[model samples]
Target: MVRQDIPLPDGPVRTCIGCRRRAAKRELLRVTVGPDRDGRQTVVPDPASSAPGRGAHLHPTRECYDLAVRRKAFTRALRLTGGPSSAPVGDYLDSRHDDDRPHLATD
Candidate 1:
């Protein structure tokens, strides 16, 4: 019988679209692009991280959000031809409170 030399990491790791840091999947928030009523693409938050589509992970902090926008990471991460507005994400983040941010502490 053959044995593997190295073992895989215990949990899944994903890169943050804003801070560009790799972290456990469960420690990040997932966002997906979906179509609105007008057929225009809109950024949607996947709090449960179970949305059925391509998703980008991000840290749930305003700092990360600003950095992501300034760096235009969303366009590349979300695979959009044009840079999508961050309003949807900003609004969503605004609705959240400090008490809701249990996994957002940075090292």
Candidate 2:
């Protein structure tokens, strides 16, 4: 049998729009297309996955976010008109991994 035909883990899985890697739904962040100040569509982080509409998944790391923006994956995945603003997602990733991140205590 080919590798492609094999079934993946039995659970909810989503492809990361940024890195394009499939992972468990809980491990990736959910983003929804929302409007910016001028009413233009933009990608917004949906941590709770409560936004109503087509949502795209992404890795929380900044690297993945950059890949998505650079590759225009967000626009293609979300079917956004024009180039959607990525500032919201960028800001969220930045804030989520600030200096306040807890360091592991080594024995």
Candidate 3:
């Protein structure tokens, strides 16, 4: 195999599936579909963005999550055959919302 030493972009940017806003990669949370303990495919959060397969980015907030769900972004973004539940994402966001710290997305 051959490799080329090409210059890379200065910084990375990703768009939020919820807000549809482009922001720095670090500012968004990467989520990808994965199997739950039951072996069923489910939407899971990838805060570290290390998960395999296609992934979608979104701000970690309720409003964004809601918008994403309403618009069925997860289904299209992840390209799933059947609609996947947002429970995992909701639970993840809810857990973060319970925190007493500032968040990237407000409302």
Q: Give the per-residue lDDT digits (tens) of candidate 2, residues 28-54.
A: 999999888998888999999999999
RMSD of 1: 7.5
Error of 3 at 64 (Å): 0.6
Give me the runs in candidate 1 sitting further than 4 Å from their true place. Answer: 1-9, 98-107
- Please give the clash total of every predicted structure, in order: 0, 0, 0
Instruction: Provide the overall lDDT of each model, using Cα atoms, as 2-decimal numbers.
Output: 0.81, 0.89, 0.88
Can you write out model 3's per-residue Cα lDDT over 1-107, one digit (the tens) per residue?
Answer: 42356433359978899999777888888999988888888999999999889999999888999999999999999999888877998999988877857668776
TM-score of 2: 0.83
Global local distance difference test of model 1: 0.81
lDDT, candidate 2, equals: 0.89
Off by over 4 Å in 2: 1-7, 99-107
Model 2, position 59: C-alpha lDDT score: 90
Give the alpha carbon lDDT tens digit for every residue of 16-91 in model 1: 9999877788888898887766778877788899889788989988898889889988778888887666678877
